[model samples]
Target: MRILLVEDNQALAEGLSTILRGSGYAVDAVADGASAEAVAAAEAYDLVILDLNLPEMDGLDVLRAMRARANKAAVMILTARGTPEERVKGLDLGADDYMIKPFDISEFEARIRVLLRRQAGLRSSIVNYGGVTFDLNSRTFSSQGVTLDLPAREVALLELLFLRAGKVVSKDAIMASLTGFDDDLSANAIEQYVSRLRRRLAPHGLTVKTARGIGYYLETTAPTA
Candidate 1:
């Protein structure tokens, strides 16, 4: 999932961004609330790690603006606000969760998992679409009750498609999800991956449908006449 981390501390921001990126999550970090607000407003992020004290605007103000603009991304306030009033204020401002500094990385990841699962209303680690099953934590995929041997990139593609099943996902979005910075990708390469996936998944009763000039969607099977 994509996340925007708003922390003014350089070291903290870099550390958190590294950890999230290493865990296969798309991460963007900003040291000030202005950049955070701009980035958050410009793009749709799955989560936001915000700090209370910012350079220009307060983190609470940022949260308020986000809510004002109707951005529903999960907001986790990461600050030194341990008092009841501070926490309550942040929560009242539409922050989904709160975390204090000096936090354990392991606990942070665990909380992130819980928050994401909670947001998705998914109690289980498994995501099922048609005959395709994915264990989100393990990064393993199975089809027709058998495991499928897929490259990491292919697996990423599958994850995106499965997550957005029954909805058309634009090719541009897919490219952005799969290709990180410093990686070059071509449109033809994406088509090739989709083609390969189609051939492999067809045997297991899953179809990745293309919408001509639009994008692609996942389905259980080809439509009947």
Candidate 2:
């Protein structure tokens, strides 16, 4: 899933970004609320990790603005303040969850998982589509009784497609989900990966179809051979 992390602490931001990436999340991080707001407004994100204290604008103001604009992305507030009032204010401002500074990374990750699960309207970690099953925590995929080993990028790509199965996912969106802000690769790079996946999935009666001027779609019904 794609996430926007609004944090000012350089070290903490980097560390958290790394952790989220390792967990198969595409993360874009900014040190201030304004940049965060801009990016969040412009792009599609599954969630936001917002810090209450920010340069340019306070995180609460950011949350308020997002709500005013009807941005429905889930948000989790991260800050040094653990006071009841602060937590209440954040939730009232439409924050989905809250985390205090000096928190456990494991807990933070668990909370993120919960938020994403809720967003997807699922209560479990397993995502199943077209007879393929994915274990989110283990990052493993199984189809037709065969387990396939996928690299992290492939896993992320597959998850994105599966989440929006049958919908045309643009190359730009795939790039954003795969490489985030550090994408320097050609647009056709994603096509290469999709081609590889198509070959791999052919035996399972699934295929990735390119939509010419649009993007790609994953379909369960196979073409006539």
Candidate 3:
């Protein structure tokens, strides 16, 4: 999934970004609330990890502004304050979950999973489509009881397509989610990856259809076994 992390702590942000990416998530991180607000407003993010203390604008203000604009992206507050008042305030301000600092990485990821699941209206961690089963926690794909190994970027791409199956996902959108706003990838990079993905899924009776003059779509048809 695509995530926006709004944190001023450089060390923590880098660490979390690495971990989340390794866990098959596309993460874009900013060190201030204003940048966070801008990125969140402009991009399509599956979730947002917001810090309460920020430069330019406080995280609460950012959340309030996002909600005011009817940005329905799921938000989780990351703060040092673990007090009841702080938690209540964040929730009241529209934060979905709150996590205090010095938290366990596994627990943090678990909370993120919960928020994403809730957003997708999913009750289970495993997402099934056609004959394919995707293990969100393991980042593994299995079809017809055969496991398919996919690299991290490919896995993230597949997850994005599956989450919005049948919708046209633009090349720019895919690039932004995978490479972040600061990185530069070649224009043909997404096409190359999509081509590779289509080859891989061909055996499974699924395909990534390119919408000429548009982008790509994932469709389920009879397996070509």
Candidate 4:
């Protein structure tokens, strides 16, 4: 998953980013609300971890601005404010989830998983379709009783494809979501990754269909006799 972390606390931001990266997510973190709002508007993220108390612009203002611009990415408020009114205000501003400060890391991670799954129209941890299964929590991909040995990039790529299964995923979006904010992975590199991932899925009754001048989509198939 690609996440934008908006936290002003340097120590907390570093710790959270490290933990998020360790869990196989591509994260772009910013310190202040202005930077967070700017980045969120300019790019696409699967999730946004926002802090309410912010500099330049208040966190609620940031949320309102994103929603005003119709940015529908899942947002979870991570703030020190632990009040019902604050929680309600965040929700009303289009936050998908709320987490009070001094939170359990495990619980926060679980909430993130839930939001991602919910966004993908999934109601469970495992997404089973077309002879493939993805364990969201474990970040594992398995098929036909065998888990495909895939690199982290390929794993992230496959997850995105599965999330948008039948939809046409533009190459630009794929590149942005799979690579980090500072990554210089070229368009050619993305194509190479897609090619390799295609080969791996082919034997398992799945196909990555290319859309010329566009991107790719996943379709299921059974091996022919």
Name the best candidate (by TM-score).
Answer: 4
Residue-wise lDDT of candidate 1 within 1-225, one digit each (tens)? 677889988988888888887766777788888888898888777788999899998999999999999998899999987899999999998999999987888889988877766666689889988777988776678965689988767787888888788999999888776654445779999899899988878877788889999889888984222
Q: Per-residue lDDT for 141-214 in model 2, tens only? A: 78866787777777778877877789999887787767667646577778788888887777666678888988
TM-score of 4: 0.93
Which ten-residue region of model 3 has the weakest summed lDDT? 176-185
**lDDT of candidate 3 over 1-225, digit per residue (tens):** 778999999999999999988887778999998898888888888799999889999999999999998899899999987899989989998999999987998899899988988887788988888778887767788898888888887888888788778899887777766776666677687788788888889888778998897888899977775
- Pairs that clash in candidate 2: none
- Local distance difference test values of all predictions, in order: 0.83, 0.84, 0.86, 0.89
Tell me model 4's lDDT, rounded to 2 decimals.
0.89
Give per-model TM-scores.
Answer: 0.84, 0.90, 0.91, 0.93
Score candidate 3 by TM-score against the native. 0.91
Winner of 1 and 2 under lDDT? 2
Q: For residue 13, what is the lDDT in candidate 3?
A: 92
Residue 14 in model 4: lDDT: 93
Query: Which of candidates 1 and 3 is the stronger one according to TM-score?
Result: 3
RMSD of each: 3.4, 2.3, 1.8, 1.7
Q: How far is candidate 4 from the true structure (C-alpha RMSD, Å)?
A: 1.7
State how far residue 51 of model 1 sits from its true place (Å). Answer: 1.6
